[model samples]
Target: MRKYPIGIQDFEKIRKENFLYIDKTQSIYNLIASGNYYFLSRPRRFGKSLLLSTIKEIFSGNRELFKDLWIYNQWNWEQKHPVIHLRLSKLDYQKLGLYEALSIEIGILAKEQGVELESKHLKGRFEELIRKASANGKVVILIDEYDKPITDYLDDLGKVEENRSIFKSFYSVLKDSDPYIRLLLITGVSRFPKVSIFSDLNNLNDITIHRKYATIAGITQQELERDFADEIAEIQQHQPDFLGKLKSWYNGYAWHEEAERVYNPFSLLKYMDGRDFRNYWFHTGTPTWLVNIMKQNREYDLENVHIGENALSSFNVEHIAVIPVLFQTGYLTIKGYNSNNRLYKLGYPNTEVRESLTDALLSAYRNVFPGNDSMSVTDDLSESLKKNDMPQMIKALDVLLSTIPYDHWKAESESIFHIIVHLSFKRLGFDVRSEVHSATGRCDVLVFTDRYIFALELKLNSSANVALDQIFEKGYLRPYQMDARKKIAIGINFSSEKRNVQDYLVKELE
Candidate 1:
């Protein structure tokens, strides 16, 4: 069996060490041929660094590394260009600051090319390097994680703005030195607005959502089947449903409306290594600041988060919003796109994200670390729901709610309880919808399982019977009556004083 390159981002190292590599050289060929300046935004650990490194190797005329790769014969080996590759993620901006890091990186690039800079500023040094490097041949500028410096300081707005100013000035050199550049490519986790990073470089083509390049940074199903045929065969021998389960857990990322689905390369590789399905991608780096921002803003209702094509690409960290940040960071993905309306519906990509993100939100809302407490409770709740054990389900949820810290009960609205119940069901891999509309009125929560349909109504400072009465009075279960699955109505009341479930009731609808 060949070694899987889990953390190896260097193209030459992978080729030299004989690590398992997926062929993405065709995409690189198309990328260079299609545009001079390009920008691609993808989630972290989705192989952006590897993509950049591969591009560097191609531009630097490393033909030996592409021994059996697709672009070996097609690429012009004679046309060698000076490659100035800078990976911002390698620097700790929190310690050195953006200006210092930028200066040090640019200085190193200059020292490599034996070029001298007239000015000490980052902008001047960058411009001077491009001019000198391109004097012989046009310079191929490759930047990886361009937004890392700015995103690192998301919590500190003053520092973030300062870094943005430095980036704006530094990157403006790309536009100014366009004549001296052969190809400029930037890859990052998020794409900020023009006023933020690419204000001057308006001509930079953003192929993030382009159908052709959608699979550039991810592993498509075809690539998986083609590259890991042996592994798949072995897994199928041991686990018959391995492929189906694998697809459910980590696949289904679509950039365009009709684009083919792609899997998270990091998680897929990790799963392949151990044959254990886990939230490898989400655990890599939880968006703590992103979750905190959503919690602080009280943006709990995320089921209907919609954005037009324009708004989806508009990401500004300074004025942080939930939709753009979550979508860009891989917490949510494109579910559906309405061509007529030009609006995109966003949701969690797969079970890993759907379960893990809700768990993160649960932790943030309760102001408690998500140890085994919540997980155990959700597990018990799911089993109870499966067996039609209403009392056990209620007990599990009430116990879980009681664990929330008293001081965390700051919200007086009923949405808090609604959101908690919704998240709990969602975390357990149950289909849950909050504020779902019915003919009579909107239901507080609707849960769907293979054998049961649960309609729940939650009341804050009222009797459980009152909530139950409202469920029947409002005809909340009417829509599910015609379905073949068993229908159940549940009511729960919460007390702000106790910071736990006050009472609960459940009824089966005939």
Candidate 2:
């Protein structure tokens, strides 16, 4: 009956209260030994706050807390530094404004350290606090969620710029106060451009994608098996594929291309506690702004996205890219990388993110609320596919398409139709491949169920007979001839005027 630290980010509490603590102290020690100034960008609930908390305790000379940890006897415990920890997410910035809220936070830190600040300005106060706190020794500064104040106001350009400017000026103090700082680590969800926040403080080493520190925050597979063997064994008794299923549901996050994949600790802990596979991490918050951005760009094809290092690294308020935002926010993760071209292949980290994000995107595209209208349509579609009910499937597709508001049809009719169909099938947990290539030709969509394989060709403002003829003429089902499942060929046509499925033909491939 070990206590899982679900939602608990305090290291002292987890250690003192006998909670299950995954020892990440080895990586922490390596981080401190390697550099003094570091910046790490990880998605929310991926244990960024907990990492900072652990570091805070270590610097505060809490040697007893690390009695059984890996770093207990690795180094000298005599050296202690004053820790100035600030979590931007906890600051009342929305109500007090960024400047005032930050001022109050820093003032509180100074009071805790019994140091007096004579400066009235935010930047001056921060510098004064650091210098005074380091009177005995250099201060270890840890700022968690460093970009929350700006990211929370993304929809409002005026407020975003205002907060960005405030942070720029405030953080610049760190550059001149380097002598008083023993170590600095800033963690955030998004990496704003250096010019925005780190232009003056250019010494901060960004370990977000650094290979050595990639597993510094998340729970690795090795750590999972070693730390939670008892819980895993208990779950394995009933479900033979418990570990595999857990990996597919909660693992596959990789910051560096060559690093070992890590699981979302929050989701993993929840699954272990309840012995149920659920989207535990996604339910905590919905990325409404991210969904809106994807919808605006008509970018639904999220798998196998290829981008260079520069495009995947950082973004700012003036220019925001979908892939970087997706990568930074945990919707996507590094799957592959080409060193020659310096291109990274990004995709959904695991089943939880893939399914949950697809549901969100599909709901937004179809203008239907999730679990209300979209869920019924997708469930019906899934049931129809499983039963080989062609007419019912077509009806479900028509209903799904018809729900979209007329004004939302900005993209080309065929493209929009393909996106909706692909998303609908994906939302139902089907294996769907869009624009699949074959030897002779390319199929519009290929769907695979447990007992059936569907090769679909789509035509816009054309006859279903022509579409069916092309599917046969091109031999689209040739690739799946040995798939062992019942192979079916489908040709569908849509009318721009009707804005729904006009007609379709289905044929069983021998």
- Candidate 1 matches the true fold with a TM-score of 0.96
lDDT of 1 by residue, 262-343 (tens): 9999999999898888889988888677777877887665665789987887776657767877888887888888888889
> Cα RMSDs of all predictions?
1.7, 2.3
User: How many collisions per candidate?
Assistant: 0, 0
- lDDT tens digits, residue span 231-250, model 2: 88887788888899899999
As a whole number from 0 to 100, the lDDT of residue 463 in candidate 2 is 80
Model 1 ranges off by over 4 Å = 370-373
RMSD of 2: 2.3
lDDT, residue 10, candidate 1: 96
Kindly report which residue stretches of model 2 are placed more than 4 angstroms away from their true locations once superposed: 369-373, 386-388, 402-412, 437-442, 449-452, 473-487, 496-499
Clashing pairs in 1: none
- Which residue window of length 10 is worst by lDDT in model 2? 368-377
Query: Where does the lowest 10-residue lDDT sum fall in candidate 1?
Result: 369-378
